[model samples]
Target: MPDHQQRIAYLLARYADKTCSREELDELFSAIGQGDGPEGLEQLLEEIWQARHPAPEIDYEAVYRQIKPAVPVRKTIPLKRIAIAASLLLLAGTAYWLLPSKRTGKQATVLIQPAQRRILPATNKAVLTLSDGTTVPLDSTGKQLIQQGNVAIRQQNGQLLYASQPTDGNIHYNKLTTPRGGQFRLVLPDGTKVWLNSASMLRYPTTFSGKERVVELDGQGYFEIAANAQQPFKVKVRDMEVLVLGTDFDVMAYGDENSVNTTLLTGSILVKEGSTKQLLQPGQQAVIDNQDHQLTVKTADIRKVTAWKNGMFVFNDMALPAILREVARWYDVDIVYKASPGAELYGGGIGRDLQLADVLALLEGNGFNHFGIEGRKVIVLP
Candidate 1:
């Protein structure tokens, strides 16, 4: 073997064993990108794939290409550039990179059917409730800016932007709400950006003049607060409050959940629940128990926590009910459980843009339960 091929083969082996460091992973991809043909690292991966699965009936590359036709065969492949393509191709069976989920060493597969009912994914649709109680329907189609006093609110390229003139006296507040099966993005008066998930609402002032910029949030929201050392940004969600000078974080405080979760992605935050306060560092999560009023902070998987904002539904050993709750909110459907799959944990990543049928098919393919879709309702069978 050539020296370069030998190095590539060694890197591929290290990758297969999951022992490749960050620098090694980058080098491996760079080397792969510099080379061509399946005679090198590709063959090594094929051997690893075959060794992992004794079934000779399955041809990895063939099946991968069949599932994802858009991914053309490249002699020289860059891992970052071809990551999604590789993930899609590898997600069909064992050794999947873009899997729906797996838990307790079990993988979840979504069975595709020609006749399954398809419910399209949610879109950027919401309603803006002004201070005067006037509700304005918002969608990606609208281009005009709605003016209220000195503030200009507009939906440009699917994002709601707030540009306001200087004001001294009035602090008019408005609410942005996304109903079931909808989502929206907003740029606050302070240039802070917020992405509201389905069945979520954000209440904020038209201008920030006070000592602190405070907002109220219901359901789930991902925020990128504009830096203001003097004026701390605070988010009041249910019984918990997240205070930060400027940070990127995700807050999940749905009323039905037992606890309120605030996951900080960047910067720091002070999470206060009742009298108990907890400080969170970057990549840390604060969980507030609603019943006991206890607060706890722990390390968080930032990717899984912020997946929804990145247009993916990532489940990390998540319960079926919890997953269904998200499906219910995003797809805007009612879930009637005829049989309970107790304590079953799932792990996987599915595209949030997929149709309802596609998601349900994955659950049904597991053979643990059957699902029936009637209108906007989902019936889970034993």
Candidate 2:
């Protein structure tokens, strides 16, 4: 091992023994940033494990046998504080080999990291606008239910549910809006589930008495529509309309993007923009140009598109500005770009639960190191 690796081993010993100083913790974390591949990390893990379990002089094969039999319980390991940083480096494409050698085909994971400055993850928060123009602040954990006529709307643990009561012929509309640093889930009166992303809005009726169940959407939302063939669900986004019956789909119609994307997950959906209409199958996406209103359908990666609803930020050939836009929305931060990474396509997946500084550090590890944060503003250096 090199001198730095030796030092890392020594620090790992101190860390495992819970005797490492604050300075030593920072040093170990910095050394972890310099780690090249899984070989070095594996050696460090072995050293740390041995330090924690000194009496058991077990070899690699013995350790593997001990873990391979039944379902091994997950225990907190040493360097828990810095593991998130290490994992971020690996996720940012710094060293793909930094992943464990044993898990070659497994998906990437996110770990919690300590940062000098932190911007916490977005939470389940939103505002409700009723048809009577009354505003209600929604809390994910609140049991407050708003009764309007035959509709009962209540929020429970990040999900807004609407239960039906005895209804008349009147139809009342309700709107749910998520702020920049928030997200929300809603169950419409028709039993359709919708996951609204940050900076999005959904306007739907409290009771669907009409022949067509229509809802208006702005920004991004994932929908799992109820199988009601009698009343097809239609989501209107800008000038486009997505018509579906008993299907799962995602609609992204943010104002910053030049196009509106409707990705079909399970059942089929018809995306209509202006006079042009396109039918999308499962794993297909319909891209409608915001300016020209031209609609084009293509195959898409459903996981990548729906990753936000799954608490992940999945970038597949995404541009830097676009990625930063997402970060800005989720973190509720302002961004200033000093130099543009024109047409640079980045591919990676990181948990959306991470703080802003950790995400930026991951980008720095991936060689985009010229960035500074002042207050809630991020300055991208040249």
Candidate 3:
């Protein structure tokens, strides 16, 4: 092998064995970005892949072409992000590159064949429960589900819409619950729009009848509240309350998470837990500790917080277990950890549309962990 090819091969070996230091990883990316000896490098990567998993046939030249054009030559890329990107290129039969642009950087994903299992991604699906204790299953089909008083409940284009007549004397409540591997969009009677993540539920009244338009959320939901200066919009999640007067925000109060995070994208919101209240401005986040109920404010990563709504999974130095927790919810699968995955953090963005096996392949390609699928369970192998 030539000197550059030998260096690249050596770096690949170290990367495969999980022994590459930060500088070495950067050097590896730099070497690849140099685009030296393309044919030799492609052959070398193919040989490595064939040696490990000989059953599959992959076009190394095509894969390399797909990757090389997308990888930005910037040296300022984070180590973990670059590592994950390169791992996807070599092991996952895909590549997710963070390409620099004039505005915010964008993610480019290239996928290949042999995604062994087809466990698909989440879609627009939920169950609606009426105040009269009746349940209605909702999907992407466009049709009127039922009528409650003067309000017409319909599911159209994967969204649940409540078209109401004039305020009747009677007020009823309805709940929309998204199962595992499911998500939904909702338009409340008061004109507020909500995007519910998987394994979440939202309960709201048929109309904004009282002094306040209050709704209850049990999991994650992004809200675009309609301006109602007289009757403020309030979101109740467990013991905490998000008070808003026409704003855009996201509330994540999942049971498995240790904190309730309320991120404000625009306007303002007052996050109150009991007597303690923290007012949040646009681009800020209020985090309430699940244990002690203490609240703290911090600058929010808007992209990461709203990635689900935007059809991406953006991780920034997130640990393996937490990442899998998200995976389990979206794929509607159980995760079994056979051995403890060490304190390795990952950073990148993957499309939420990919199948369970494809997502696992990208993660497992990082070389620190291996995954197996059995029935509806993803096993973390030692």
- Which ranges in model 3 have alpha carbons more than 4 Å from their true place? 1-116
- Residue-wise lDDT of candidate 3 within 78-106, one digit each (tens)? 33333334543445555442211111112
lDDT by candidate, in order shown: 0.74, 0.71, 0.77
In candidate 2, clashing pairs total 0
Per-residue error (Å), model 1, residue 158: 1.2
Query: Per-prediction TM-score, please?
Result: 0.78, 0.72, 0.73
Question: Taking the tens digit of each residue's C-alpha lDDT, what string does model 1 give over 203-230?
Answer: 9999998799999999999999999999
Q: What TM-score quantifies how close candidate 2 is to the native fold?
A: 0.72
Off by over 4 Å in 2: 1-116
The candidate scoring highest on TM-score is 1
Order of quality (TM-score): 1, 3, 2
Ranking according to lDDT, highest score first: 3, 1, 2
Evaluated with lDDT, which candidate comes out highest?
Answer: 3
What is the per-residue lDDT of model 2 for residues 26-84, given as tens digits with 9 covering 90 to 100? 57656665434345565665455544544344343333232221111222323332343
